[model samples]
Target: MLKHKCLDQCIACTACTVQCPVTAAAREFAGPKMVGPALERFRLFDQDIEISADYCTNCKNCDITCPSSVPVSLFSTLAKAQYRRQNGKSLRDWILVNGEMFARLASPVASFANITMNNAVVRTMLRAVGIADRPLPKYAEKNFYRQFAELKQQRFPDKVVFFPGCYIGYNDPRVGMDLVAILQASRYEVIVPDVVCCGTPAVANGYLELAEEKARRNLRELRRWAREGWPIVTCCTSCGLTLRQEYCELFRANGADEVASQHYDAGEFLLEMLEQGRLNSEFIPLAGKYLYHAPCHLRAQGIGLPSLELLQSIPGCEVNVADAGCCGIAGSYGFKKDKYDIAMKIGERLFTKIKDSQADMVVTECGTCRIQIEYATGVKAVHPVSLFKQALRFDWVG
Candidate 1:
């Protein structure tokens, strides 16, 4: 069912191949154009070759540069799922995909979990399981939902539910807090729902049934707000994309396609706010060279780099759009022991570019990319919203 859509549109001009930084960096590696179609061929004959799906970092550069408008990364993900199904899921897959379970289990003793993650023994175990040379994020003292519950109990004017994804909810509550502060400052009521996993990890790992179940749950929870004409805002690109696209798949299968069409990513939602003159900010001069790493999923959404647009609006900020491709942390792909070296190798070019640029900070919309970039560059990477929040705090633009 997931056949490559743009096969007929492809001119074989090699435009996509040439535009891909991944292919350019790794000459032996097949770019998305070839890989996507090749998977179709492999699937046709029911061949079980792995096709090195783990090699793709899912940066969406191929999609961004493709002239024929192919959904390169989406198809590549589908192909990865195919390969994962044949080769069997890795230990790292089990760890990353069952993130919700781990979060819930760790919530009771979150401090212990946080300490354990930072421990040398635990780091070795993590490396043994597949993650290498990446620092794990510390778990929050309090989860996002708990923090949201406290805020919601108090009175507010306009309410907007915040979907901070699993990482922000559990690992980095600062992001959630910052988002709440921003929404409150904008005079909007912020609600934190008792949300479950967004099912992106499941979908990526080929657990389609599990993903669909989670999607249905999320839809039922958000449908009321949708009916009320309120927007569901998420800070993570994967969560936003899952809400915008995968939830639609659930509706299409259940004969409710129209409702699925209304989901919005944070960038799309923010751009809408900007156009409507609902969002305004005081520019804070952030002195430093800033590079924007567009996440693969964000690029796949075809939003025309709204994150960079938002960043550049702040005066005295030098934003560099990196020619560097994926950071090679394609969710759980780069964390596996077998794929760790390859992931590092793939990420080296981007890391080197960022280091060479001598940027003050790297900003991106995807939480995973932030993690990967920070791990690779040792430069603090943050969400664009955080910078925007900082800009709003300034007294004067000049």
Candidate 2:
């Protein structure tokens, strides 16, 4: 984020650079502290930024590791967006950033959409557009919105607005359904209103205006719910970070303060409810050990590993935290043909850890991270909520 005031506070500390996963992976990255804060003074005079802005994946590792709270990733995104504005965005960039719109279009004909999307012609066209040859996830048969409508919740006074970001809305409705079931078990009525992508993909793709526009589209509903004191919980770590962190940094959107203070990751919310003596402790013990990867966005929120803690509490579930670093797919960063190799290289450490752990499955909060893990290591990966759903013996609604 490299705000001017934040840059001014930089003590020339190499802490951020030292902790950056990209810098560790690629020597050309020029590190976070140098490219962000150090370059700001030169950038003010219109000195062409010698460093490649695209080198940054906007993973926020620098932001999280900074001692002075400088938003290193913010500066990267801002610079990239500015660069794109001056130049031009390609069709591939447009498609990746506007994933919300594409998912909606693919929903009704999801089966056919996947086929056409993967056809040889489509792959060639996608490559020409600068998108990767990587296989895209098929849209969920029924989006969570439709599934939420079918949910027959026992009315409760306490309610929460579940923010099912793009992944849950169009790709993994089961996560959302599992989330709703857990909340219902905890006696909280889940109210899922009309919402759009939180725009994490847009930010990563350097489409600031589109990202903010999508944020506005969803904030109208989020703001009203916030005003009424409803907790806005998101399962997707990227979406949670966008709602609680990015909105204020970029647009300073209304209700953001309330939302930031009140929003929770689904795992964190469940743990919080459990701590206050409200969770349904009637979990049927799950068998086998689990390897958990704490998503970078989840860690960015400054909340302790609530999901990991919760998973360990389940009887017969031996949990091992993947101690490895970022799992490369920072939003859609890994899906670009150019960056795909860098993404995989960055994830090598995590993949090795997952493989060595010898767990039956890998669990993480980000949907894209799950995709990356499965691709890199041939092991099944799932959200922590999926394990919770099984442990709680709640039937999958999707």
Candidate 3:
């Protein structure tokens, strides 16, 4: 049996609580130290102490800030799984977490779905059911999977597997198309593997078993390519983080370590190529002041701002890190009615910073961060890879 990792290592240093955006924004959240490492001790004895793990948001700020290297967010995630086992999940959670299922179902009638989601009556009904009144992402008429099927790519000896998470695959396929163009331009053949949701939304919503099962399934396919030394890359920060770190830390799924070792964020992968002098430097110079927001999960990976590094290398592209903290939409966390206000409150710092910057564009790897930034600051947000595609002057036909 697997034991909870590093709970004993916590010396009760309140660093995690200090860095917790949720705790700062909302008092109801019992703070990471309290609900995580502290209550975790009680949970070890089957004490079943009341925990506010639901408010965690699983942003991994605790893990990032923990001086002792304790997996604080893992404890909260485990608590959520345990809570789900005892009390079951709500309808709102079911709808929010099963994004892939809903996306597939909604893909056929995407236009209608988008219209229905924006209808005032629909918003009222969604609010009653605990979904936030904030605008939902519109479903793409052709999902990334369908678009990838029709895509014809120039063959290259080097190949990389692309894991476009549910958001890019279903909601905004243009990002995936941008990634494909960038990869192809870099002389890498892109392979869209038949992978599941990377289990982030499910894990965030407390579906531990479901998340683990999906992890194992993905590991099987990912490991096959990994063993052959093919790199697994993702445009989504959360999905990339899940593939590279969470699987090993949380599920300990077989081959998770091997797969983790080879996984890379698309920007990180491109940055590597640029550093190795393998990147295509023939770029159309686009002059603009850009602000980059590093996703919380990406920061947790301990990779030092690869997207910012890459974006800065482009001629005439002035890029600056937002450094304003978390955007507060922890996957589907902000979509919940009760948590929406807290999410917005947590995001205000970033919003204020973006508004102050007067940036021509905001660049970020996380899709939800783009949504939250645009929604809060009324600033346009584009993915770093998408920006790179634009720099390369690639015409994207969606």
Q: Point out the higher-scoring one by TM-score: 1 or 3.
A: 3
* Ranking of all candidate structures by their TM-score, best first: 3, 2, 1
Q: Please, what are the lDDT tens digits per residue for candidate 3 over residues 1-398?
A: 23355766788879999999999999888999889877877888878757588888999999999998988888889889988988878889988888899899899899999998899998998899999989999999989999898988888999999999999999989999887877777788998888988999888878988889999999998998999899999999999999999899888888999999999998899899989977655778878999999999899888889988888888888998899999998889999999999999999999999999999989999999999999998899999988887787544333
**Candidate 1 Cα outliers beyond 4 Å, as residue runs:** 1-11, 19-31, 48-50, 83-87, 152-158, 249-260, 280-289, 394-398
TM-score, candidate 1, is 0.84
lDDT of 1 at 138: 61
lDDT minimum window of 10 residues, candidate 3: 389-398
* Tens-digit per-residue lDDT, 102-129, candidate 1: 9878977899998888799888888777
Colliding residue pairs in candidate 3: none
Residue pairs that clash (backbone atoms under 3 angstroms), model 2:
1-71, 1-72, 1-73, 1-74, 1-75, 2-71
Question: Model 3: how large is the Cα RMSD against the reference?
Answer: 1.7
Model 1, residue 89: distance off in Å is 3.1
Model 2 spans with C-alpha error above 4 angstroms: 393-398
Query: How well does candidate 3 score on lDDT at residue 18?
Result: 97
Residue-level lDDT tens digits of model 2 in 1-398: 33668879888889988878888887778888877888877776777556477788888888888888778887778778877887888777788888888999999888899899999998998898877778888898888888888777888999999999988999999999888888887778899978888988889878999988887877888888888988999999989999998998888887778778879899998898878878865789889878999988888889989999889888999898898999887877788888888888999999999989899999899999999999889999999988887887544333
